[model samples]
Target: MKKDLWIGGEYRSAASYNELKNPYNLELLAKIGSASQEDVRLAISAAHQAKTMMVEMPAFERAEILEKVARFLRDDLDECARLIAMEAAKPLKAARAEVNRTIMTYTFAAHEARRIHGETVPMDAAPGGQGSLAFTVREPLGVIAAITPFNFPMNLVAHKVGPAIAAGNSVVLKPASQTPLSAYRIAEYFHTAGLPAGALNIVTGSGSKIGEVLKKDDRIKMITFTGSPEVGRYIREHSGLKRVTLELGSNSAVVVDEGVQLNKVIPRIVNGAFAYQGQVCISIQRIFVHESIIDEFTEQFVSETRKLKAGNPLEEDTDISAMITRGDVERTKQWVDEAINNGADLRLGGSAEEGIFQPTVLVNVPLNEKVSCEEVFAPVVHINSFRDFSEAIDLVNDSKYGLQAGIFTNDIHKALQAAKKLEVGGVMINEIPTFRVDQMPYGGVKMSGMGREGIKYAVEEMTELKLISFKTE
Candidate 1:
C-alpha cells in the first residue's frame, strides 16, 4: 500500500516515499510519501495562508468540527487500533485501549473549545479610577507545528492537533517516520469533517530535515513536540522566540510500602512495567519496595512476569509483542548486560530473539548504572528495597528526569508527605505512576519535559491571552 502526503487539505505524491514495515515481523505494510524541504515550506506557507480564516472561525464551529472527528474515530475504532498494532508493534488489546483513550481526548478537546475562558481584571478596584472596565480573551496562535512520536501515535497526535484545531489555529504536523499511517488517517478525518484546507497539513519524512524546517520557519508560532530530551533541547535552542511544549523522556519510579497488599498492587506493577513492551516514557522503571516486604514482592512480581504471552501483536491473547524494532531490543539488551556486569542480579528473563525481548526484572542494580538512572525505554525494570520512606523518596528524586512517581501506601500521612516531597510533575498515591486519564494534566519536569498535555491544558498551550479594556468616560 502507498500513502501520499496530505498538504493543504489535498493528498499529493512526492518523488520518493519511505517504506513503513511492520516492526513485529518486518513485513512491508505501506509506503509514506517522503516530504521534501519544499514540501515542508509549502505546508508552513499553507498554514500561514489559512491562519486568518481559522482564527476568525467561531469557537462553536471549531467545536462542532471536532465533535464530528470524534464520531468518525469511534466509527473506525477497530481499524485504527489494528493500524496502531501493526505499525508500532503494540499489542492488539493495548492498541484498542489507546483508541478509546484517543476518542476521549478528542471529546475532551471538543468540550475545551468552548471553555477557553479568560478572567476579568478589577481595574476599578485598584487605586486607578471609576468607570474603567477590563477583561481578557483567549486568542489562537496562528500556526502550530505538532511533531509527534511513534509511541501512542494516534493519541499523542490528538493531544497536539486536536487542541490546536479546537483553539482555532492551523496545524502543520510531522508524524514519526516509523509510523505515519495513523497520522495520515487522522488528517483524512479532518479533511472529511469539513476542516478548512491548510487548517491541518501533514508532512512526513526525515526528522532532522522536517524538524529543521519547522524550527526555522517564521510562520510557526508554537511547536508542540513529544519525543527525546536531545531533540527537545535542540528545538529549544534553535527555535528562537518561538513557543514550545516538550513532552520528553523519563525514568519513572514506583514505591510500595510494607502495609500494601501484594496481590492487589503486583498486577498493576506488572502492567505498568511491561505494557507496550515498556516503550512508554512514564512506564515504571524503578520499584522501591519497603525492606519488610521486598522478598514477597519480588517473588510474586517474577511469577506474574513469567505469565505474559509474547507473540504476534494481532493475536488477542498476546499480552506482549515485539519492540518497535530489533535495534531497540539490542539496545535494551545492552543495558541489561551492563547492569549485570556491574553486579546487578538478573532475577528473571534477559534474552532477545529478533524484535522480541523478554520482560526482564533486575535486583541489586547499582544506582549509577544506566538501567537504574537513565530512561531505559524498554521492557526492563530495577527493583530495590528501602528501609525508610524518606530514603525511597530520595531514590526517586535522585534521577535527573522528574516526570512522575507512584507510591503505594495505606498510610495517608505517608502518601501525602511523599506527594509533597517527590520532585515530579505528578505523584500517584496508591496508584502506579503510569496511571493517566485523558483529561488530566500530563507532562513532566526537568529533563522529562515542559508544559502539560491534558486536552484542556494543551488548548491553553496552543493559544494566547489578550487583555482588552474599555475606559468609560
Candidate 2:
C-alpha cells in the first residue's frame, strides 16, 4: 500500500520513504514517507493557517465538526481496528477496544467544546473596583505539535488531536514511524468531517529530524509529546517560550496489602504486566507484596503468567504479542539476564524464542536491580517483599517516575494513607496500576511527564486564559 504525508488536507509525497514492517511476522506492511526538514516547515505553515481559521470558527460549529468526525470513526471502526492491529502489533481484541475508546475520546471532546465557558468574577469585593466586572475566557494556543508514541497509536493520537481541534487549535501530528497508518486514517476522517484545510496535518518520518524542527519552530505554540523520558528532556531543553505537555515513561509500582484477596488481585496484576507486551508506560514493573502474602502471591502470579499465549497478535487466542521490535526483545532478554546475575530469582517464563519473549516473573529482586529501577517496557514483572505498609509505600515512592501506582488493600485507613503517601499521579485501591479512564486527568508527576491528557484536562492545556474587564461609572 502507498502511504504519503498529509498536509493541508492533501496527501503529499516526500523526498524519501521508509518501509514499515509488522512485528509479528516481520513482513513489510506499507511504505510511508520519511518527512524532511522542508516537509516539517510546510506542516508548521499549514498549522499556522489552520490556527487562523480555527479562531474564526464558531465554538458550536467546531463542536459539530468533531461530532461528525466521531461518527465517521464509529462507522469505520472495524477497518480502523484492523489497521491498528496490523501496523502496531496490538492484539485484535485490544485493537478493537482501543478504537472504541478513541471514538469515546473524540465524542467527549466534542461535548466539552460546547461547554467551554468563562467564569465571571464579582469585582465589587476588590480593593479598587466597586462597580466593575471581570471574567476569564479560554483561547486557543495556536499551533500544537503532537508527537505520539507507537504503543496505542490510535488512542494516544485521539488524546492529543481530539482536544486540540475541539479547543480551536491547529495541530501538526508526528506519529511514530513504526505505526503511522492509523494516524493517517484519522487525518482522513478529519478531512471528510469538513475540518478546514490545514486544521490537522500528519508528517511521518525519523523522529530526530521532525522532532527537532517542531521543538525549535517559533510558530508552533505548544508541544504535546508522548514518548520516553530521554527524548522528553531534549524537547524541553530546546523548546523556547512554548507550552509543553509531555507524557513520558514510567516504572509504575503495585503494592499488595495484607488484607487483600490474592485470587482477585493476581489476575489483574498478571494482565497489567503482560498486556501489550507491557509496553504501556503505566504497566506494572514492580510489585511490593506484604511479607505475609509474598510467597503465595509469587506462586499464583507465576502460575498465571505461564498461562499466557505469546503468539501472533492477529490470532484471537493470543494473550501476549511480540515486542515492538526484535531489538526490544533482545534488550529485555539482557535485562532479565542481568537481574538474574544480581541474585534475582527467576520463578517463571524467563526464556526468549524468536521475537516473542515469555511472560516473566522475577522474585527476590534486589532494590537496586535494573529491572526494579528502570522502565522495563517488556513482559516482565519484579517482585520484592516489604515488611509493612509503610515500607511498601516508601518502595513505591522511591522511583522518580510517579506515574501511577496501586494498592491492593481492603483496609480503608491503609488505602487512604496510601492515597496521601504514594507520590504518584494516580492511586488505585484493590487493583493493579493499569487502571485508566478516558475522562480522568491522566499524566505523571515527575520525570514520568508534565501536564495531563484526558479530554477536559487536555482542552485546558491546549488553551490560554484571557481576562476581560468591564467598567461602568
Candidate 3:
C-alpha cells in the first residue's frame, strides 16, 4: 500500500519514500510518501493561509464536522486498529482499545466546540472606570505544528489535532516515522468529513529536519509535541515565544500499602507495568511496596508477570508483543543487567528472543540504579520496600521525573494525603499510574514537560485570549 502526503486538502505522492515495516516480523506494511523540505514549507504555508477560514467557521459547524469524523472512525475502527497493530506492533486488543479512546477523544472535542466560552471582566469596578465594560474572549491561535510519537499514534494525534480544530486552529501534523499509517488514515477521515482544505495537513519525514522547520517557522503559532524531554527542550529553546504543549517522558511510580489484597491489585499492576511493552509515558516503573507485605506482593506480582504470553502482536491471546525494535529490546536488557550487577534481584523474565523482551520484574532495586532513576521505557518494573508511609511518599518523589504516581490503600485519609502530597501531576488512588481517560487534565510536573492535554484544556492551550473594552459615557 502507498500512503501519500496530505497537504492543502490534496493527496500527493512524494519523490522520496519511506517504507514502513511491522515491528514484530519486519514485514513491509506500506510505502509512506516522505515530505521533502519544500513539502513541509508548503504545509506550513497552507495552514497559515487557511487559518482565517478555520477561525471563521462557526462552532456548531465545527462540532458537526468533528462528530462526523468520530462516526467515520467508529465505522472503520477495525481497519484503524489493524493499522496500529501492524506498524506499531501493539497487540490487537490494545490497538482496538486505542481506537476506541480516539473515538471518544474526537467526540469530546465536538462537545468542547460548543462550550468554548470566555468571561466578562468588571473594568467598571476599578477607580475612574465606572462606565467602562470589558470582556474577554478565547480566540484561536493561527497555525499549530503537531508532532506526535509512535506509541498510541492515532489517539495522541487526536489529542492534538482534535483539540486544535475544536479551538479553531489550523494544524500541520508530523506523525512519528515509525507509525505514519494510522496518522495517514486519520487525515483521510478528516478529508472525507468535509474538513476545509489545509485545515489539517500531514507532513511525514525525518523528525530532525521537519521538527527544525516547524520550530524555526514564525508562522506556526503553537507547537504541540509528545516525545522525549530532550526534544521537548529543543523545541522550547527554538520556538521563540510560540505556544507549546509538550507531553514528555517519565519514570512513574506506585505505592502498595500493607492492607490491600494482593489478588486484586497484582493484575492491575502487572497490566500497568507491561502493557504495550510499557512504552507508555506513565507506565508503572518504580513500585514502592510496604515492608510488611513486600514478600507477599513480590511473590504475587512475579507470578502474574510470568503468565503474560509473549508472541505475535496479531494474535488475540498475546499479552506481551515485540518492542518497537531490536535496538529497544537490547537497551532494555542492558538496563536490567546493569541493575542486577548493582545488586538488584531479578525476580522474573529478563531475556529477549527475536525482538521480544519478556516482561521482567526486579526487587530490592537501589534508588540510584538506572532502572530505578531513569525512564526504563520497557516491559520492566523495579520493586523496592518502604518501611514507613512517609518514606513511601518520599521514595515516590525521589525521582527527577514526576509525571504521575499511584497508591493502593483503603484508607481515605491516606489516599487523600497522597493526592495532595505526591509531587506529580496526578495521583491515582487504588489504581495504577497508567490510568488516564481522554477528557481529564493530563500532564506532569518537574521534567515531565509543560502544559496539559485534555480535550478542553488542550483547546485552551491552542488558543489565546483577547479582551475588548467598551467606554460608555
Model 3 spans with C-alpha error above 4 angstroms: none
By lDDT, the candidates rank as 1, 3, 2
Root-mean-square deviation of each candidate, in angstroms? 0.8, 1.0, 1.0
Q: After superposition, how far is residue 119 of candidate 2 from its true place, in Å?
A: 0.6
Model 1 misplacement above 4 A: none
Question: Residues 1-473, candidate 1, lDDT per residue (tens digit)?
Answer: 99988988998898798788999999999988999999999999999999999988888889988889889999999999999999999999999999998888888998999888999898877677578888998899899999999999999999999899999999999999998999989988988888999999999989999999999989999999999999999999999999999999999999999998999999999999999999998999999999999999999999999999999999998988899878888889999999999999999989987689999999989999999888999999989999999999999999999999999999999998998999999999999999999899999999988999998999889889998889997
Pairing residues by index, what is the TM-score of model 3?
0.99
* TM-score attained by model 2: 0.98
Clashing pairs in 2: none
lDDT tens digits, residue span 1-473, model 3: 88889999999878889888899999998888888888999999989989999999999989988999899989988888888999999999999999999999999999999999889998867798788888889999999999999999999999999999999999999999999988888888898888889999999988998988898889998999999999999998889989988999899999999899999999999999999999999999999999999999999999888889989888888888999989999999999999999899998988999899999999998889888899989999999999888899988998889899999998898888898889999899999999999999999988898999999999999889999989887
Report the lDDT tens digits of candidate 2 across residue range 1-473: 88989998999999888889998888899999989999999999998987889998988888888888889889988888888888888888888888999989999989988988779888888688887888999999999999999999989999999999999999999999889999999998889888999999999998999998998999999999999999999998889999999999889899988867788889989989889889998999999999988899898888888888878888778888878899999999989999999899998877787788888999988878778899999999899999978899999989879999999888899999999998888898887788988989999988998999899999999999999988876
| lDDT score of residue 190 within candidate 3 | 91
Residues forming the 10-long window of minimal summed lDDT in candidate 1: 124-133
Candidate 2 regions with alpha-carbon error over 4 angstroms: none
